[model samples]
Target: MADSGQALARRLRQLRQQQWPDTTVRQPQLARALNVSVPLISSWENESTPKVPPVSRLQTYALIFCTRRSIDGDQLVPLDETELTTEESRLRDKLLHELLDLRTVALSRTPAPGSAPANPWQFDDGNRIVIVCARLPDELLTRMPYVRPEDPDYIELYTYADLDSLFELHGHIRAFNPGGEVRRRTAKELEPDDLTSHLVLLGGVDWNDLTSDVFQVLDLPVRQVNDWGGDEGPYFSHGDRRFSPQLADGRLREDVALFYRGPNPYNARRTLTICNGMYGRGTLGVVRALTDSNFRDRNTAWLHERFGAEEAYALLSKVRVVRGQVITPDWTLDGLRLVEWPD
Candidate 1:
């Protein structure tokens, strides 16, 4: 009989094989995308009863595969709790509850500038919700078996940075008790704004130099931008950068900007510069560039080949100019609709 971990791995592998038959993905790459070590991925593929990736990691994966038209649009296939052995079910519930609690607490404390605050678990309903997070490569999302060729849901898939944004927003909402009630803000009320926003700096600082204020604001794991949402949440690197755009000579230049991927937020601003640039000229060139092999390969290479357009666009979309004077920063250049270039 297959153990639970084996069963889960087999199911996941089957789903990938069935959905992304032509795609070439490796264990190391998947491991990076999920922010776990390559050995862990190897264990999963080899049927070891590896610990489950955190809810946050799973959520990221679910979003990727679930949005594909092929997978029936269900990011997380609801498992039958009753079907699990009594002990297994209980353990699973326990883990889920722990994660939900951690997230709740993390989001409740008032964060100081550039830091994540302590988690607050003062709400009555904090125990009721189970939000599992996961991270998956864009290739997985695009190549999944049940996904559609052109799906809007897939287009809106979130990245580790985006998740960080949401996590920060959650913290802000928790601080305001927006409704003046304990932990009572709706999702809408948790939207990100300047006062409640955080800037994730990426490089050149010792982990020891990180301020409590930065930790409280981002609510991220110490020195890491990507973190899982469970008892055994794994930390992943989101290399130094954010997002930005530029326009010149009737061309739109898009970039995946960052500073550095490290354990400290103090250097986030230093490494934060436009890193990846996407250029577009005419409509045809822009469309082609969007799906160009060179562009995809180059961009994926920059991300250590663990992500694709799904993740790329998600990061690109979140870019907001915190403080700067740009001639054309709003996706348009001199009153012209900028086009997306290939590489």
Candidate 2:
């Protein structure tokens, strides 16, 4: 059985690598996308870890590698299924069922965003929902999945968490109006007027320009931009305290994400939310922070009951991410403290 599982693991790894043959897909990247741990991804591909991923995750793998319709309506060649063998066909069917079965997904989908409790931050159909994503330079293309094909010069690759955040917010906005307009823009392209809309910045400063821009005004305890000589971050600084992706002993620290939700500095009438991290795992960690019920409730309650939007804007908070999820045993949104803004 283990040998068969190893064969299956190899096939899974092969299929995953085939999606971006020219690019290097690291285990941490896959883990961040699938909302699993790096060790799990390593184990799945290692074939000797004595552990196997669940069928639901295998379905996610298929979605990432097999499904392709183009998010931008650009036509692409479909995966050739006619040549699949009987076993291959059966496996494909199983993956699909695991992903689409209502009974399996009902519990997770039922809550939805923008429902009964109501979104306290003041969003309406009239206001546009702008999703700002980070655009990496051309030099980094070899490490990311291809997002936009037309832009051959700069391959705008977004982590699974970035796409996941976009869809999650889109769903929440669409719940208010099915025909609601949700626009996507890069941080580099953001303008003064764009800040007037309800905004969501997808990635942190390292990859997203918008997040970098927003951090300037908020002055959070953790910042992505700083003058640290030769070192670079999704870096965070609070007075004399500084934390980087590297630990004090020189070993790389586990990823951590900074989540901010409050008012937009450019326009007080609109709200701005940031789900970003120092790295891809940190980025996914921020996404998990926003989506997790415990964090969401505390944050939501704090937004609604503790203080107004602008006050919340002045303060910032952080959550530690171990794998791809937020560590929330003692996490509370109300626990966020104020960021001492310069006069």
Best by TM-score: 2
Overall lDDT per candidate, in order of appearance: 0.31, 0.54
Over the stretch 1-343, how does candidate 2's per-residue lDDT look in tens digits? 2454555566667765665455445565567667878877877677664244554465556545544321113222233466555665566555544332321122223333634233432355467778787655666554666555755654443522366556555555566445556777777777766778878788766667667767787756565544436645446666765556544454334544556666777778777877665655555555544355434433343333334334444333444544344453222222333232321
Question: TM-score of predicted model 2?
Answer: 0.49
Distance from true location, Cα of 64 in model 2, Å: 47
Instruction: Please report how far candidate 1 places residue 80 from its true position, in Å.
Output: 28
TM-score of each: 0.21, 0.49
**Residue 129 local lDDT, model 2:** 77
